[model samples]
Target: MFKTIKNDLPASIVVFFVALPLCLGIALASGAPLFSGLIAGIVGGIVVASISGSSIGVSGPAAGLAAIVLAAIVTLGGLENGGFEKFLVAVVLGGIIQILLGLARAGIIAYFFPSSVIKGMLTGIGIIIILKQIPYFFGMDKNPTGDFSFLQVEWDNLISGLLNSLNALLSGNISVGATVVGIIALGILLLWSNVLAKKAKIFQLIQGPLVAVVVGIIFFLVTQGGSLGLLKEQLVSVPVPDSFDSFKGQFSFPDFSAIGDKDVWVIAFTIAIVASLETLLCVEATDKLDPDKNVTPTNRELIAQGTGNIISGMIGGLPITQVIVRSSANIQSGGKSKMSAIIHGFFLLISVILIPTLLNKIPLSVLAAVLFIVGFKLAKPSTFANMYKLGWKQFVPFMATVLPMAITGDLLLGIGLGLAVGIFVILLKSFQNSHFLHKEGEDVNDGKVKMTLAEEVTFFNKGAILKELDNLPENSSLELDVSKTRYLDNDIIEILEDFAHKAKERNINITLVSERGTVENPPSYIEFFKLRPKAS
Candidate 1:
């Protein structure tokens, strides 16, 4: 894993910067203590990465689970009654459930997701990142950083929130300093990634996002007390502790007393199902994004995520999942192994203790600028065009996934809709491609029609086959060839038998040819298939 330290170390630093605010923001959104998110991040990075077979996937507290976490907290009797502590119980149980799922080999479900939907997922997330960061980019951020759902914890949706932010900006409530810093940071990122990094190895070693952040801090320092000075709210907000003992107070243990609570068990199952799904989807997407195209073991990822969540909950943290934003950041920043994820966790651990005060000085707008690049890279215009060129079969499902995610802010709903569309497309193709007529000149001239069955015909093909038989010219001789067919559905066999009965009325001669043998006006098409060798 250390073989690529030159790459992984720099990437880890980038992920560390990207993850810090998200950790705090998601915790805040979930109505949990600010430190809990950091705990999840630390455990996800260190524990999860250490156990996972995925080299590039970075697990952490997910925004997707924020709503559930918030609701679960309330249902568990609110924070006053150790609500957060009880939620931790659910998280631990959820982790155990995920481990069971992994052991059951349920990760195979990830393989069934269509490529079009997966690409759509990546693109949709890209668009979401861009959209969510727009307010932050303009220094009008009101919602949390990592909240990706359509409905935010703040009660307003993305569109309304953005409109409100814009209205505020138009009323001359703009943060000029934040905007200026963000633009400079974005420019630095572009220059470093596109040009400077290519020109020298030193540029690559020192990542652009890190430089942009440093520049943001320097700008913050120099602009203090000036008209363009940033407010405390405009900067990173890592909770500071007075001493080592006080720092220890930030950690909260789960309340095992809630273990027997029915509500806690329900919440546990919910988290298990949702977290596992998100993890599997992310594993698939991350593998696609990898430059080397390394495949992650999905089952192992589930087990690793489960272990991470268990540890995180034991110390008070939100549920963990394989988060795409951080994983994408790690990959874009040149992370080559799990070491980057592990090191980033350590960075989160060390920085919160040693340098959180300095971290607090970095402008949120600069981080916004960093995410803008990540968003743009994921949702490039070229991707849409490419998907379009693949035709409706691919494009429809892609849009099915992208639109819901971008518009409604529901990742699972979008994927569900896209998967439905993908399945429909498959069935449609199967219906249309069941069989083809060979217009050989000799057969046509002799009043004979030859229909070749596809390699595999399922029940979906029954309609097309029935329609073709009904349209066959009267008194024509038909050559039904299944020579190349391997698996034919019983429904299709029934269609052929029914057609044979009609052929007698039209005085049509039917010749069935197969690898088994040939039959002239076979009395039973089903019986013939029954006699043929069955697949071993």
Candidate 2:
């Protein structure tokens, strides 16, 4: 993991910059202490990265869980009445539950998700990232950076938020300085990534995001107090500690006293289930994005995340999950292994300890510009065309996931919708594919109608197979072929038995063909099936 420090170090720096604002913004949105977000970031980096099997996945306080955290905090009692502390207890308990889930092999749920749906998720999130950041990119920083949900912490959903920013821009209710700096920063990033980085090894050694951030800070410093200057609200805000004691004071220990509360347990289970789901989804997506295509162990990843959450909660941090944004950013920045994630965590810890004031000087717009590239890369036009070319079996589920997620700003909802569509398509195909019919006199010139069963005939095939049998002409000879079938459902066997009786009354002579041998006018279908060996 440490072998690619040259690549990982620079990539970690880029991820750190991208993660910093998100950490703060997610905390702000969650109604937790801003410092708690930083704590999650630090632990996710140092602790989670160290334990997790994932090479490129980055864990942190997830924006996807912000709404749940906010609701839980309010439900357990407001922040004033030791609510946040009690929530920490839930976080720790959630970790325990996640560990149990991992032990139970629940991580296999990730494999059940369709590839089209997963691709749709990545693209949907990319579109959301771009849409969410537009306000920030244009210097109309109204909403929190990391809150990916449709309903904003401020007001309105994603579309309205964009319109609001556009209106603000037209009405001159925007920061010209931040916009100017953002444009310049974007230009620098584009030039560095597209042109210069390809020219030399040194260019790749120093990343574009880091350069963009530094230029943003310098621009802010140069324009301070001028008409075209960035306001404090337009810049990254890390909670600055006045002293060592105060810094230590920022950490909030879990309120173990609330362990007996039923609500706490409910919240704990909710977090465990949601956080695990998010982590698994991210793991699958990250593997797809990986240039090396190294598959992370999902079960191990759950255990790692659970452990991270336990440590994070004990130290007053929010719940942690493997986040796609930072993970994708790390990949885009050339991160080769887990070292980048670990180094980025250390960067979070060290910066907050030593140079938080410096970090605060960077402009939010510049970061928005950096994320624009990440979003574009994920939601490229070519991906849409490619999915379309794969046919409706792929494209339908892809759209079902992407469209709802992009419109509603709900990730899981989109996945559920896509999964539903995918299952329906599977059933439809199964129903259509149950049997292949060789019409009368096609195979044997004896006017026999032959129906070949599929490789695996299940209850889902019952309707189609029954319909074919019922349609057979009177006095016709029918051949039932199961030579290709490996496993046949009991329901299908029963259907064949009923068809046999019906065929006898219709004067149809039945011939059953199997791998064992052909049966002539079998008396008991079940008896014949029982004599055959079970599928391996």
RMSD of each: 13.3, 13.5
Clashes in candidate 2: how many? 0
Backbone clash tally (model 1): 0
TM-score of decoy 2: 0.81
The residue pairs in collision within model 2 are none
Clashing pairs in 1: none
**What are the Cα lDDT values of the candidates?**
0.86, 0.86
| TM-score for candidate 1, residues paired by index | 0.81
TM-scores for the candidates: 0.81, 0.81
Candidate 1 residue-wise lDDT, 1-536, digit = tens: 98999999999999999899889888888888989999999999999999999999898998889889989999998988899999999999999999999999888777667778888999999998888876677777654466465445443665676677778778967789989999999999999988999999999999999999999999999999998798888888888999989999999999999899999999999999999999998998897788765658788989999999999999998999999999999999999999999999999999999998999999989999998998899999999998897578779999999998887778898999998998897776645452443433335567788788877675445445655777788889988888877767554675577677778888999999999788899999867987888654
